[model samples]
Target: MIKENPLVVSVGECGLDYNRNFSTKKQQRYAFREQVKLACELQMPLFLHEREAHKDLLEILDDVTAENLTLPPIVVHCFTGTEEEALTYISRGYFIGFTGTICKRDRGAHLRDLLPKIPLERIMIETDAPFMNFKKGRKSSEPIDVVDVARKIGQVLAIPFEEVAGTTFKTTSSFFRLD
Candidate 1:
């Protein structure tokens, strides 16, 4: 179905979520593996969701790649992982998607330090909240919240907000091959 739909640019929002564990570990791994295989088979980009399951996720990726299946372009969405995790992903050439979560001081304090470590070209901002209660106090997350995320990145990296916005826009567009 996804391959037939031209509007579906990516096999998105699919990955492991050990923190929630809505599905058993066995179930999550099987489903995640299927999606990974599908993305590789279809040669489509993957917009992934991972929480507290980085190890297993990496293992699955390695397992797939070990089989001589080239992994497709992968973006980890709504990233709220540690600095080490960020570095690990970056080292492997995977894009990290930061949401409004990074705008919050208490929860995202670590991210402030990690932002600079990320290469400018690989950075991407996601304003639309993905099952997250972050940054916006009580107001529901919205697309405009991306501004706050970009501002936080600028503040942390000591770059101008406009620069952050422009850079992330360009990087995101290029990553997804957007026109």
Candidate 2:
């Protein structure tokens, strides 16, 4: 199917989500492992989603590596984790994707503080549209809001918006091989 469709660029939005009860651990583990294997088999990038399950996720990834599987590029999307988690992903040569959650007036402060810890080359921006709305009272968002995410990241990192925009755009393009 992936070979038949040129648009299929990645395998994911896959990972463990222990913070939510939407899926059983066994089920999530099965799906995540299958997707990881698929990404490796297809030589496609991986779009991961981790939440309060980094320990398990890391272990699984480590096992895959131990087995000598050639993992493809990985991006942890909509990340809102501790600084330690960010560093772990960075150390593993994976990219991190930030969403509008980093723009909130209050809840975003911690994320802002961690921005400086991530290299521009390892960072990407996303809106997580209709989900991670950061406006003071807004309950939804759109794709254009990724600009707000980049702008806020600039403010937090003491960089120019244009630089942030350019860096994130280049990082994302490179990761997904958009060009």
Q: Per-residue lDDT of 1-179 in model 2, one digit per residue for the tens? A: 77568687778889999999489998998889888988888889999999999998988887787878989999999999999999999999999999988877677778888889999889999998888877766789899989999998888888899999998899888787778
Evaluated at residue 174, the lDDT of candidate 2 is 76
Please give the distance, in angstroms, between residue 178's alpha carbon in candidate 1 and its true position after superposition.
Answer: 1.5
In candidate 1, residue 170 scores what lDDT? 89
lDDT, model 1, position 134: 65
- CA lDDT for candidate 1: 0.85
Residue-level lDDT tens digits of model 1 in 101-161: 7877687888877888999778889866544556545556777778888888988888899
Reference-based lDDT, residue 53, model 1: 96
The candidate scoring highest on lDDT is 2
